[model samples]
Target chain A: MCTTCGCGDGDTRIEGQGAEGWHRHADGTLHHHAQPGAHAHGATDPRRLRIEQDLLAANDAHAARNRARFAHDGIFALNLVSSPGSGKTTLLCRTIQALRGLLPVSVIEGDQQTRRDAERIRAAGAGALQVNTGKGCHLDAHMVSHAIAQLDPAPGSLLLIENVGNLVCPAAFDLGEAHKVVVLSITEGEDKPLKYPDMFAAADVMVLNKIDLAPHLSFDEAACIGYARRVNPQIRVLRTSATTGAGIDAWVDWLAAGARAAARSATQRAGPRGVVA
Target chain B: MHELSLAQSVIEIIENAAARDAFARVRKVWLEVGLLSCVEPDAMRASFEAVSRDTRAEGAVLELVAVPGRGRCPSCGTLSALAAREDACPSCGGYGLRPVAGTGLRVRELEVE
Candidate 1:
């Protein structure tokens, strides 16, 4: 019985049977009081593994709902994931410049405390919503919904969710994004994807930003691309230099195309399916 | 590490579950740590121990199950379990590595009594 969701209270299904005798108390309540030196049940059991998968199924159901909501809103949302100081905000600034007059764009910036990224996005002439996670590491769907309510984007808008600078936890929580854009800089080694494959696998597009500084660093472009491709062959890789204005057009165009596709699908889905005539 | 926060989230989830299920204490937690998720099992274990104290999950045993990183080698048409972060195909040393699974973390199970 979950106090928050009201879905918890049920029969007792202990992981291992006979580890210790489960007694019915005076109030007819069942409890698995583990006793010392209890090895009555086998240590390795298959039922335990199935129970774990069931727990994950519940979370994935919530994630699927979020995905559908984003799709129905006709909004092209991208989750910007990366390590801190990997040029995520700088690339976003440049991307806003490239797509400002072309599309109806908005941003949801996640940080620990300061609203610096939100301020920067606002200064760049875009609607910005800031979510201060406090001690939270990743942004869940509930936080994203709150951020969306704050942004108040009109129908058919492009929402860029700049997730907290983390390559691990953010991948677990879906932000209802059509794409996950992982921004990696050349200063970071090419082995990043290999080390953080979950982030790379979740990302639909990989932006190898700060390419202008590639000449000064020992980071190999070929190795980076290879490593990213190894993790996600379907991921669209783009090299951009915010300071140098390189590959900005491609990024903007990709975003525009995604927004258009989302809008078209949303319209098509909403039109039929037994309309209320 | 991000696993610290993840462990915290797992604790919160279990606590909530316990509160609703009329369970006073959490006996154990079964966690699934994906190989490609970048969540160090050691870090998660340490964080769990540090945060679970004085809570519903206090002194609860953490059982970790490692999910193998299974990927598809595009060039070789081989699906294999990746022991580490090596993207190269073990048999053919191919470059085309496509992750088929093991890219996320989950709090799989909880035992409460």
Candidate 2:
């Protein structure tokens, strides 16, 4: 049995389906037979049962471990995903500044190069860890695990992982967060969520940032919210402008509530067994 | 672009499959890209060629089957073959359209030697 998810079978042909592969038996009960002229060709057959699982499977396992670790440590983690220049770092800085006194906040900023986002977060008076993905486009579970170790926030703390500026790959890899929040600037089209449903579907919250520039731009807040709802009905939408501190309080309150909810769940899980008197 | 990473993932899956199947060379790859997947197929193909160089899948033809976005329209039932801008239901013109399919990105099959 596979230990990680306990769903692994020996069958390599059908991933998560059955376990049929080369087998050896002492009593000759069962064994897979080699195909005819197996050694004639150097390459494997293309029609062989596809036992190969997703390449991100390992990263997913690590993400699960990170999730359990965060729960055990009473840490509330949020995975923030968005496109480039969507103001994730700017919104994060403003949020950190606003929520610094309410609760202990930490950030894990991801980028292709430079610690500019981390520097911005630090300037806002919050603990920040920069994760440079180098050539990679997204932040995986292992990277977040390492960054968490570096942040080392106190129990009942909030940690935000700002994923690399990409909407697609980051959505495929979960970073062990209580919630996945997506930031969209007003400059981006209102139909963005419609165009990128998977990312919006994966997100638990959607922040429409840069509302201050709404008048200067052609962005429609209602249409954006409508499209976001169309992609994910359960998504909580928040409009904000870091430049003017607009809607900062509501976003901060939402973060605090999220942290409290996560901490409460962790405490309940650690308290006692289900059978109570 | 993120499509590069996705193409790399497809290569990994195919390579691992080849190793198990004992195939040395892959002739072609067929992939199903859903409209809602947000992956640009052109970019993905470019990335596949660039990253698969020198690998078992080098020079392999990447055939993409583009699947139209599927959606569940609140005004109607399941809808398919939707136009890029029109996500509304055909019967009732309701705007509540939840995607039902066309969000998958996977290597469906491989022709190997």
Candidate 3:
């Protein structure tokens, strides 16, 4: 159970899935073989199960399902991750406003408490759902799947999942997103990338948020980008300011491209077998 | 920390394996922790103790196998041991070393009855 969200206690509820929903094992155990003589091993002797399985195989399986569902629905899902107070919500709000009428945009806001971010997103003219992960530092695939099942963003739309504001754990938990976008504010030190290299390495894009404050703050932008590239050479960096709307267009364009690609892929998958529609 | 959740996952895996293998209880668990796997053995042990309560894995001895991180230098094509992801290649002194192994966490073997 996550100490932050009280999640494993079966209290966190997703919309449309009443309380006690979302992967609650009554016994907190999954029993695959009930009978003692089910396997070939002797019933009296001890047996060694050479289970060479990854610790996160369960989570990864859920993520695969989520990814397939997203692909089939033609929805471009982006998992936004960053440290607390890195301006993730503000940027999300700005993004919602920018792409509201042109393209349907929805948000899944994650936090330890409060519907404040969801309300802010709704005020920005986009569909929003709040998932409070009480004591959980990161959002897992199961939680995201439940949230998506309830939210049901329209096909060919963009779903922005703002992960719990943490740099470490979120990197390990895949939420079935098309890409993981990491936000780094200029207010934060440039050494942030080096300090939290896992997040930087896991992310597909690194958004340098609050760039308007770059002049006022002595943040080494080059060093920050350098550090990020050292960890992830393929990561794309976008400079943006939610307050001044400096790089909103580029961000929106990137999102649009992803949504378009998703739509195209979905169409191809839905087409006749072996036919490239 | 997320180690709690990870420990819970380990227990779940063990429980499922026990059921499939028809084991009464788990006597021991052998885990492979890679150098770049981002898991601390001490934290994992503490979390396992906390989450394995009342489960078949309770009181089970956890044997941790440490796997060293290995990377191949893209520049010199030399394979060497790496302690960190950003470690430069030892043979070539190049930063572009691709990790080849020691980045996984897995339940290698289990002793059960």
Question: Which candidate leads the pack in TM-score?
Answer: 3
TM-score of chain A of each: 0.78, 0.80, 0.82
Best to worst by DockQ, what's the order? 3, 1, 2
Models sorted by TM-score, best on top:
3, 1, 2
Which ten residues in a row are the worst by lDDT in model 2 chain A? Answer: A14-23
Better candidate by TM-score, 1 or 2:
1
* DockQ of every candidate structure: 0.17, 0.11, 0.25
- Candidate 1 structure quality by residue, lDDT tens digits, B1-113: 65666676777777666565667776667676655666655667788888898898887767655555677788888888664444678778875566676655667776665
Tens digits of lDDT, candidate 1, A138-247: 77777787677677776677888999998877887776677789999889998898777778878888998889997799998898888887767777898888889898
Please give, for residues A1-277, the per-residue lDDT of candidate 2 as tens digits.
Answer: 3222222344233121111232223332222222322223235545534342544566778899999988987888999999999988888888888886789999999999999889989998999999999999999898998988888877899998999998777887888898899999889899889777778888999998889997799887888888877666678999899889999899999889988887888888887799332
State in Å the error of residue B69, model 2. 3.3
Candidate 2 lDDT tens digits, B1-113: 77877788888888778777778877767676665566665677788889999999897766555555667775567574443323556767666466676656667777777
- List where candidate 1 sits over 4 angstroms from the true fold: A1-50, A53-62, A273-277, B12-21, B72-77, B95-112
The CAPRI-style docking tier of model 3 reads acceptable
Per-residue lDDT tens digits for candidate 3, residues A1-277, read 4232222465333332111112222443211111222222333655678999999999999999999999999999999999999999999989988886788999999998999999999999988999999978889999989999999999999999999999888888999999999999999999888788778878999999999998799999999998887777778999999999999999999999999999899999999999977
What candidate 3 gets wrong by more than 4 Å, as runs, is A1-47, B74-76
Taking chain B only, the TM-score of every model is 0.84, 0.88, 0.94
TM-score of chain A of 3: 0.82
